[model samples]
Target chain A: MTVLINSETRVVVQGITGREGSFHTKTMLNYGTKIVAGVTPGKGGSIVEGVPVYDSVKEALRRHPEIDTSIVFVPARYASEAVYEAIEAGLNLVVIITEGIPVHESMKFTRYAKLNNTVIVGPNCPGVISPGESKVGIMPGQVFSKGRVGIVSRSGTLTYEIAYAMTKAGIGQSTSIGIGGDPVLGTTFIDALEMFREDDGTDAVVLIGEIGGDMEERAARYIIEERYEKPVVAYIAGRTAPPGKRMGHAGAIISMGVGDAASKIKMLREAGVDVAELPSQIPGLLKKVLKK
Target chain B: MKLYEYEARNLFREQGIPVPEFRVVSTAEEALKAAEEIGGRLVVKAQVLVAGRGKAGGVKLAENPEEAYRYAKQMLGSEIKGELVKKVLISKAVDIDRELYLSIIVDRSIGAPVILSSPEGGVDIEELARSKPEKILKIFVDPVVGIREYHAREAARFLDLDEQTLKKAQQIVIDLYKVFEKYSCELAEINPLALTPEGSLVAIDAKIILDDNALYKYPEFSGEYVRDLSYYEAEAKKMNFSYVELDGNIGILCNGAGLTMATMDSVYILGGKPANFLDIGGGARADLVERAVSLLLKHPRTEVLFINILGGITRCDEVARGIVEAIKKTGVAKKMVVRLKGTNEEEGRRILEENGIYVLEEMDEAARKAVQLGGAI
Candidate 1:
């Protein structure tokens, strides 16, 4: 079975009245995702891009009980509230596309969501996509296609860049998820790697990471400890990023000794995963692993 | 953001932790009056955020109000660790029986909050943790259960205080934990939880770094912008954009954070040094691009401007137009290297070319062009 979502997965859009919410709503629909309902605080009983809008997640769930996944497009302040509402409504997967969320707020909700057994893809991240079958995030649709490789990353644009490079090199993906680049996030590299390990559609893995966080190093330890035999290719950015300054993402900083790219690459290579020197070099490395 | 010592004292005072009588003053005359009001022996401290203020001659003890004024006059307008001293905190100096250390920090490794305490204090904890590991006590607090009285007792016990001192120290531990939790601080610490000669505890110096993300809920957080930022930094802050100035010649602008860093790496790899790291963020419009370009060109060291736009969600044409508009408005003839890819590349290239600005097809070539144009400027 495919991981996360398939073509039959019913979806709800939070903050559907907002510009990003409405735009991505159309983008997802165009990519053949099942858009069942929409939710905004005050804009109920209306339709957004031919999809019904409700005042709250509760109302949306009541109207459409088939809804299992929610894509959040709310702003930073109300993002946690939206996630809480979705968790309360019993949705299994919630993908947040909002940026600039506070670390404490993110920590509270991520901890809360984990306790409830709900899967959250991002708070300040691009959401997930299962190629050909279903698309649930705001990643450009033209760059992806249905295939056998499983992909996971902390970066958004670089995810698209590498995936495009892979597609150009005749490699395609089964699933690609952005776990967000925040300091504290709901999902980690290991979580996605574990999912890819179990999924029958995925034969190998490509982990895209950047400077910051011990998640990549921890994932390497998990790989070696579990002795998972699937081929994994990794690409980590920010090789020239300075120490102690945040480079865009809340989580992408080199502070207090961990999360540098050089150390991450060394660890990944030691774990038997092929680590690429550049984003453009990933596909060739992946091809070599697949041939072996 | 880190709170000044005097500001941190106020927070400690509110949490029921005892602080020595103090006044925060901006001028030398005000420092004299504050010294007089506090009476007794006075400690004149330069209120800069940097550490090792004592070694930097930022901290001093005064025998009289005139001496206090003299110290404040010398410290103010002086540079401490490259940051200007804007305010001084004058506190009644306490005669210490012993110096002890206590701190509650957000430990990312434990995935929860933790407290560190030591019988030996007034020294850097990092150095202590390195040189004398066993002297420090570490206790991790569970998030769901919250910090408990037992946790505080454990920390006090580890510090090896007597029964008489243990009860009061435990209360202070709990109070510190409360400040850490309530303020959404990454760290809440008192380096020297001074043991006064008269059988009382006082937080002589303290530091609290609030989580920037959680600052939204703390509406008063805006009033805490006390740091002296560089010219472009303040302008960028006012515009609600992320801009960092560096000592280099090539100015850069990119949409996403990862892409921006990658661009910088490319610049450095191709022998170009980026003057600043400017991220317009994802989905930026034409006007934002214009502002970003103008700001980059405004820097005196900038020899060439590099704009790398991978327009996935953001349209490429808008970026191209922003470059043209910015150059036309600012009239800054600094050389620019442009790379426009992803969505609508052809039309974006057309827009730039029509405006007499050339767009490169490859990021590598564009970076090379920028470096060659800069030529070690």
Candidate 2:
């Protein structure tokens, strides 16, 4: 009943021998994710942290037909090709944790994933997690609790902060996904919202958004048009963020009002979603919305 | 990274795209010499990254070499749109029969490289798109297939060019696409692809924004393709921390993009302004945290240092070690508000508390403390 990943999900690690790949592989393993195989392109016939490493995603898939999900920690330049390999190998979901990928490369793989109907979590984002079931990506597992809230965001550390706040407030989450902060992303807000809407276990949703891109605006409109009945609580990150300033690797060049947090908050408010003024206010807002 | 006009011109010339015969000069005397060597009425254009330089008097037409020198002197060491005109490009001013606009940039809406062309160019393209949408023709080129001949032909036809000019324009469009890809540019634009009275198409002005992500692969752009960084920015660069200066009193040190921005917003919402934004990117150990905290304290306006660390891959205990080390090294007796949660939270809080640093468990409480300590000005 959980979306994207669960205990039944078998996994493979692309770039599993890399510093980041090998590091998160052990983390995912400790989180109780079924790490069945690893893909390192040329480093086959090897193993990382007791998991078999194949030379290619195809070979790994052959050895473990049950592997349905993959975590990609490939270097930024080679990230797109790795995602394509995962998609071509027929992995149902590909979670990319690498940051600073060129927008062009991100577009190519995201489009490929789309045309093939394979779900992608992020190229510059933290991956998704279903607490108490299975964990993927790099969010600290201790901060997440199994419940009805479906959390999605465009940030990594930010996701951890909110997830921690929720956990501290005794709120449990069904699934929390970081869709990435890049202007061109694999999964959009509407896409994640739709997935949560269909998942029977997700009773409410917490959307953590930031300034930059029109994804949040579009998501708000979609909520109104679809009349999504879930008690969605939203928290936008960059109210004082200067426009077009490169905040970080995840910084956005907001050309106009289209990408501003103000417009997004307005749209979400008009859509009848409870928008929290601060990240710390999110838990209370969600409780208020759920109680109503 | 914005390429200067002179650099873009050089790139165009190297690509065999027709550009006006030009020479770059740093001084008025050199400008006069170059203008005299060209032996014609010249254009004196300031070599800077900012836009609206033309209207800002950074661009001028000189009837003679002496006039070119006068213009250069007026421009060099002068500020246009907040960018100093360090160099001037002097070129033989061509007689224009027409002007056209062409640009190729990655468009998010299309999810591919897009070609935007307009016959009535040399003006603000955004305004043009807003007012006369019909004047602009946008073509979304397939990323895999790239800029095919037919896509260029489609763009040329949209510009209403004659058969011969259409062919020439088409080739130029294709060449521009190559430049975009070769240099890893996010945007390559020809503001006025001027058609001269001699029936020759020339790129009089060019703009290229090299993709920032691609900078690692193209290290040459550090001095060539970009402007000089501010003092703090350059220092922060060496420290491996993402720091941007702002006009405020509270200095923010945090991990993760979302958390840092949330901290900034929290400060503003609580009636405090952040002096700078610093993200010791995920997995920052003690040294980085110490270095970052020291950097934040270096700013004169920074009165209250707010440390917000939410541990995911970034351990709170490591951040605390950095904070304690920074306090020791910098000997900063200023007020600091620390919010540490997630992994190793208890250890991190204890480390800060043992060092006489004030710590708050809640973000709201930490922000309130920061604002209260920061006070007015």
Candidate 3:
């Protein structure tokens, strides 16, 4: 079974009335996601694309109690409250796409979700899009097709580029999850890698990392410890990032001296994962790994 | 996102943590008044954003009001780093018997906040960690459980602190954890948690870097960590552009900091001088691109404008639109060369073509075009 998501997954949108939430809801709907209901406090009576918008997650659940998964699209300030509300409603698979949710808020929600036995995808991520299984959040649906390659990335836009590159090179994704670029994110590369390793449909994996943070090194050790049989391709961004500048994401700072791209690339290479220098070379590298 | 020493100390005071008595003064008259109010030899420290004030001759001991005024007069408006010192912190200098280093930072390795303590203090911890790592003791706190009493005790005992001093150090560490979590701080450090002659531990210096995303919740807590830029400057900063006003002859624009810096270096590297380093990150929208270009062209010395964006999130087509929009909006006649890449490459090329603009994809080609245009000017 694929990890975290499946065909039976029922997902609801938290900030379903906002511009980003509304636009991405339509996209996710087009990808055949089992989007059940929408949540917005003041815009409860209104409907988006015929989906009923409830005043709260509890109200949404009263009409559709079968809702088990949730996708948050609220603003950064209110993202924590939205996540807590969804978890309180007994939803399991939570995916938060809000970019700037505070780390403290995230810690609280992640702590609660962990206590309640719920799997939270992202507070800053681009959400998970499983080809032909289920789709959630804002990934381009047209670019992805059902296939064997699994992807886990720190950066959102970079994931799209790599997925596009892979598709153009005749490779498709089993599931692509953007684990977020924040320093204190819920899920790391290791969690996603373990999922991909256990996933029967996933034949290969592509891990996209960035400079700053030691998540890549931890994943490298996990691969070596578990001795994953499937071929893996890895690429870490920000090789040319100015030494001390905190690039886009809050977590991209090289504070601990462990998350540098060169060191990560070295560790990944040592763990038998083929590393790609350029995004364009991902497909060629994946093809070579698949031949093994 | 990091607060100066005075700002962090104020935050510590608010959180019920003991900090040295201090007052912020912007002028020498105010500094002298503050020193008189404190009624003792005050430490007049230049309040710049960067650290190492002690090493930079920014921190001075003043025995009287005149000395304090003199120190403040000399330090204020003087450049400590690249930043000009606009304010000074005057605090009652503590009689110190010994100094210790205590800092609480989010350790990503364990996915939890960790407390770092060193008995050998008053120096750079990074340098200490390099020279004598054994003196530094680390205590990790579980995110769920938080910093336990035992955790504090271990840090205290590991640092070889005295029983009474250990209790104060323990409470200080606990209070730091509270501040770290309560404010969503990425880092809260007391560089020299000084043990005064009175046998009390006082936070002589403090540094806090509140999580940027958490700034909304901590608005009331906002004091001086903010970079003190104007509204437009702050917006430009949020957009990830490196903007510096320079006295030059050509306006240079490029994407990627490394590329932008190298572009300026190339302009200098090739004997053709550049005006400024303008880096519009890889994700600039049309509005941002237009704004950036317009801002660069605002300089009187900007005779020629060069726009370079290696689009990944910021597509070439959008950059082209931005350039066209800027031309329509501000009518910048500084002869410009635009370099664009990534998705919609052809679209960007066609847009620039239709608008009668010179577009190039290579950095050298774009730089050469700018040089040729500047030479013509």
Candidate 4:
């Protein structure tokens, strides 16, 4: 069984009338996700892909009360309000695919979600996809095949790249989660790693990290101390960022300190986790662990 | 998105938080006039968005109006953390009996705003975290309910303040929470909130980091351009491209995270530190690469240029045309080494060769030549 999502996970599409919402809704539906209802404030009662549309999250929830997860496609400006509404509606899991959302909005929403027991995947990410069960965000549907490797990352495109590389190397994924590219996000690497550890189907884990935050180091400590049965493979992006420049992702700031790639790789190596210097080397590293 | 002490205090004052009376001034005359009108000792702080400015000789305590002039004169044109000091905050100094630290920041894992307080103020919190972590009390506030009165009381009690001081501290915390929420700040901190000789609390220092991504709501965000760059350097920045003027001869360009990094490392391995790491990522257009080359050529250290294009989704010929265009525009007779591979490698190589720019097929050979030529720079 997939860890975060499955066939039983009824979903609602927030901002379903917008261009991105409409496009990804089609993708999710084609991938066999149950698209229960859609929410767009002004465009209620309209139908997209034969799915029901409602004005607010409450209205959509009223129509499809069984919906446990929400896939949001709202623009950056309105992402917080949309997320807040879904959380207040008691949706257990929310996947936000909108890029460029304000950090303060995510911080506030994340804080609110924590007080409540809602789990948010991203505000500037590709969202999570449990192959063969439910695909949430913008991951290419073709490259993924269901297997035992649990994948999590701070990058949008790199997740797709790693997943593709894994598939090409004859490795399939159990679940893939994009933690997003924001400096302050709802969940950390450890949080996702814990979930992977608990999931019985996940045989190993592939952690895709970037140059920012102490998250990779924190995850390394967890791996060292916990001594998980499954092997963990790590690949960090942004090794070429200038000494003091901030990259595209807000979390990719490597100013005076915090978020250097070499230091993160060193920590992972010391922790006994197999670390790949390049993205292409991940599959080979994972296979070596399997042989051992 | 960090604000200076004066700016944070201004925000706090607007929110009805108790702070020393202050005026932000640019000129020495303005600073002296403010100090004279206040009729007391003043603190002159350099206006720069950096921490530890007090230790950097940016903060000065002026005992008289004439001293204020001297301090402001010294600080106004100075540089702190790469930011020029264009302004100074002249504030009426408070009589300090004791000092405490307070802050509220977003805790990502918990998804809550944690209000942190400690009696040990006017020091770097990181140092405190490393040495005496137990002295700091953290209260995780529910964002839905916000910073409650009970939470404020708990923090005050933990700070070990007297009943009257606790009340004042409680009110300040409540006001600070409001300021944090309203300003869209990621972090709002007040260090050395001094208990005055008169037994009232005054925020002696404040720091507010406004969330940079949230600046879309603030129209002034885009218009504020600080540094001056040359024509090509400006154009590269305008297109959201990363360009660094470096002390080397080779101009290296590649795409993707792993590819670009490997290219740079290869250049270094071949006994040449790359002039710049340019990733003309997916869908690389000729114009973007042209601008990239133009920016690279502007560097005084560049005696030779190396253009490495690996076309995954980006066409190799596009990268070649950009190098050719840059050669035509700059008119500089700099030595160049070209490496093109992937999608349309043959066609891309033909474009470079037709334009009289010799193409080096191997990565190592390109690096060796570029480094050997650049060493003369």
Candidate 5:
């Protein structure tokens, strides 16, 4: 019932022989993600952590036709090419874990993915995890447990932090996705909200956002426009951030007097979302909404 | 990174977009000589990266070379929007019949490049956008398709230009897009794109913000346009950490950008002020963490350091070891509240506790402790 991924979802690891790729492949595999094949170009015929590696995504697809998704841990320079390879191979989903890809490349590839009917999750994201069922990202497995609350965020460790807090409060999640902290992303809060709204297992959603773009405001508008029925709890970081200063993440900035936390919080509240001032308040807000 | 107006103007001129003839000079004497060469009423502009330069009195129109010298003397070494004006751009002033706005920006929401054009153009463009968004014409250009002839024509027509002027304006739009694409600019702006009395279009001002990630392709600009980094910030950049200085006391350090920002927000909310935002980035080893700790401890505003690490790819023990190593190396006895969780939490905690530093598992608890110890109560 989880959105994007589930236990049966077949996965291919792009850049599988690389340090991050190899490490996360084992981690995802340990979390019971159905990682069927790996792609590392020159490292074809090599096996990484018991998974067969292929030179190309096409070759890997030929060997494991059951592969439906890809998690890319390629370096930033080659990350876009890897994404295009996955998209052209007709993989349904491609999650990019690589950070620092050029915005132009991401814009082009994301558009290409859209036209090709493929879902591109992140260029600088922590991938997706369906709690106990599957973990495709680099998030710690212990912090998340299977439940009905769908979580989507724009951060990595922050997502883990909030998820851990929720887990500590005995509130498990249906799926937690880090949509990435890049300025241009393939999947946004609105896109994840749409998927969450359709998922029968997700009774509510927790949106984790930060300063930077107008994505949060846009998501709030989408919710109101669609008259979305699900009770959504939200948390936005960077309330104290100054204007024009990039707060670590490339996309996390209050620039040109727009995309501040105050405006985002206001918009989300106007959409009837229970926006928590602190990450720890999320579980309590979710409990209150789900109870209704 | 934001390019100086003169630098942006150079790029625009190189791309065949007509800009007022200009000379970039550092000295007032150089500016006078340049103004004499131009032989016309000129605008002397301070070359600062900050916005609203004109409003900050960083720009002045001079009637003659003597006035240009006076203006340049007044501007150079002067502060505009908190940025020191080290360079001045002396340009031949154009006779403007009308002013318009044009820019190509990577619109993140649509995931594509967008051209925004308006008949209204100036320092007040942002105000115009906020008050009357409809006044601006937005044309979303697909990155694959790029800026076509029609896209430019559409923009020119939006500004209600006459047939001949439309053709020239359209060409400018197309050329500007080329500059934007060629340079991998986040924003390529020609504010106050002036229509001269004789109907020729001239870019009065140029603003191009190149994407920092794509700077490798343009190595010339990589070192030049880093927009004034503070001492600590520059140090952090050298160490490959994301750092932003803030006006606070508690030095906040974490593994991820979002987590660092969240930690800062939490500290602020809990009556504590964060000194800076520092993300050691994922998979940071002990040496990097050690350097980061030393850097934070060196900050004068950092009374206490709050280190929150929710390790996924980043190992906890590595961070803990770095903290211990930093303390030993620097011998700066600053109070530190360390929160080490996720991978190898027990080992990390043990490493810190062995060095007489107690660790908190909960982020909120650690933040509270740092705030309390920092005397934010």
Candidate 6:
């Protein structure tokens, strides 16, 4: 009943022999993510956490044809190639957890993924989690519980912070996705919103956006134009950030007076979305919207 | 990384795109010699990374070598848009029959490279796009297909080019796309693509911003460009930490970029200003966290240190150990508020508690405590 993944979603791990890849592979396994195979060039024929490792995605697919999803943990320089490999092998959904990927490479691969009818979650993101059933990302699994509220954000630990608060307040989540903090992302706020809209398990949505680019503005336009049915609660970070300064994320900059918190907040509020002033206020806002 | 105008000009010239003849000089005497050698009406331009250099009096037209020297003297070492002008470019001023605008930039909305052109050039493109949207011609180019001849021809037609100028302008557009692709630039622009009296198309100015993520492919650019970095900011860059200095009292440090920014925003919402935004990044060990904490403690404006760690990949215990080590090493004795949750939270809380640093479970509570302790309204 989850949006993108569930107990039946078999997975393959790309770059599973590396430090982050190996570490998170174990953690994802611990979260019951049904990881069927691992792919690492030259490190094939090995095993990581009782999962079979293949030299390439094609090889992994041949042995495990049930694997329909892939999670990439490759380094930035080679991450794009790994994504291309996953797409070429016909993986329906690829979740990229690598950070610092070149935007140009991401642009080409994301377009390629689209043409091939594949979905990409992030290049510099913390994957995805559907709570209780299965978790495909590197997020803290303990913070999330199965519920009807779907969470999508452009942040990592920040999503966890809010999700943890919601869980403590007896507000569980159906799925949570970090769409990444890069200037160019594979899955944007609009894309995630469409997915959440169609999911029967998700009764409400919480969008976590920050300053940078016009994605938030565009999402607001989409929400209004489509007359979105779900009661959406939102929280945008970096309200006090200065102009022309990158607030940690490469995409989180207020440039040329565009993509500031004030403008984003204004646009979202106009779209009839309840915007939280603080991260702690999100649970209360969701409760208000759910009540209505 | 944004390249200097002179550097962009050099790249354009290398790619066979025509640009005005120029010499980059740091001294006024060198500028005078270069101007005399060119022997025509020249433009003296201060080399800075900031926008609106012309409005800041950093760009001046000189009638003779003496005037060029005076302009260079006035511009060199002068501040423009808060950036010091360390070099001046003396170039021959062209007799322009018409001015045009052309650029290839990665459009985030389309998720592809886009070509933007306007017949009315040498003006603010953003302002123009806002006020007169119809004046700008946008052509989206697929990265897979690249800049086709038809795309260039379409741009040339949009600009109302003549029969002779059409071919030349189209070629220049295609060449500019090649440079953009080759260099992995976020933006490669020729602000005023001038058509001279001789019917020659020349790039009057060049602006290129290379993707920071793609810098690894171009190692020759290392340490060549000047970044507007403060002392602590530069230090953070060396350690591979994302840090931005702000004018506030509470020093904010956290794990992820969004979390760090959220921490800063939380402090702001509670009426506290953050001194700096520092993200130690994911999976940071104890030593790296110690270094980040020390960097914040050394800042003069940091009166209270707010450490918020929502551990996912980053371990809470490691962060707590680093904070404890930093305080002991620096001995600054500033007011501190620590929030540690997730991934060995009990151990991290115990370590902080043993060091007299009580930890809060909630981020808002921690931010409020730090703001109150710092006495920052």
**Residue A6's lDDT in candidate 5:** 93
Model 4 per-residue lDDT tens digits across residues A1-292: 6778987889999999997788778979999999999999999999998888999989888877798999888888888889999999999999987867876677678878877899988877778889999888776666678898999988765566567778878998999998887777777888899999899989889998878777898899888888867789988766656655545566666643557888998999898888775566788998998788
Instruction: Give the Cα error of residue B75 in candidate 2, in Å.
Output: 1.7
- lDDT, candidate 4, B288-308, per-residue tens: 888777767776666677776
The DockQ-derived docking category for candidate 5 is high
- By DockQ, the candidates rank as 5, 6, 2, 1, 4, 3
User: Candidate 3 at residue A241, lDDT?
Assistant: 50
Please state what fraction of the native interface contacts candidate 1 reproduces: 0.44
What is the lDDT, from 0 to 100, of the residue B324 in candidate 4? 86
Stretches > 4 Å off in candidate 5: none
- By DockQ, the best candidate is 5
- Per-candidate TM-scores read 0.94, 0.95, 0.85, 0.81, 0.98, 0.98
Residue A15 lDDT in model 1? 93
Q: Which interface RMSD does candidate 6 score?
A: 0.9
User: Cα lDDT for residue B59, model 3?
Assistant: 92
lDDT of each: 0.85, 0.85, 0.77, 0.78, 0.91, 0.91
Give the per-residue lDDT digits (tens) of candidate 3, residues A1-292.
4567768888889999998788778877877888889999998989997788999999999999889888998988788888889888888778988877776667666777888887888877778988888888676666677788999987665676668768778898888988776777767788898888889988899998887878899999999999988888987776645455565566776663456677898999999998875565788999988887
User: Scoring each candidate complex against the real one, what DockQ results?
Assistant: 0.54, 0.65, 0.21, 0.27, 0.84, 0.83
Tens digit of lDDT per residue, candidate 6, span A120-235?
99978898999988888899899998899999999999999999999999999999999999988889999999999999899999999999888999999999999999999999
- Where in model 3 is the C-alpha error above 4 Å? A256-258, B36-41, B62-67, B144-148, B220-235, B238-289, B296-320, B333-350, B357-377
| lDDT score at residue A148, model 6, on the 0-100 scale | 94
Q: What is candidate 1's lDDT per residue for B1-377, written digit by digit as tens? A: 77888888899999999899999999988998999888888899999887788999999999888789899999999999897999999888899988899998766543567899899999988788889989999998876467998999999887666788889999999999999989988789998988877778889998998877777667776555535457887777666666777678888888787777777877887777888888888887889888888888778888889888887888898898888898899999888899888888799999999988899976668888988988853
Worst 10 residues of 4 chain A by lDDT: A240-249
Instruction: Score chain A of each prediction against the true chain A by TM-score and list the results.
Output: 0.98, 0.97, 0.96, 0.97, 0.99, 0.99
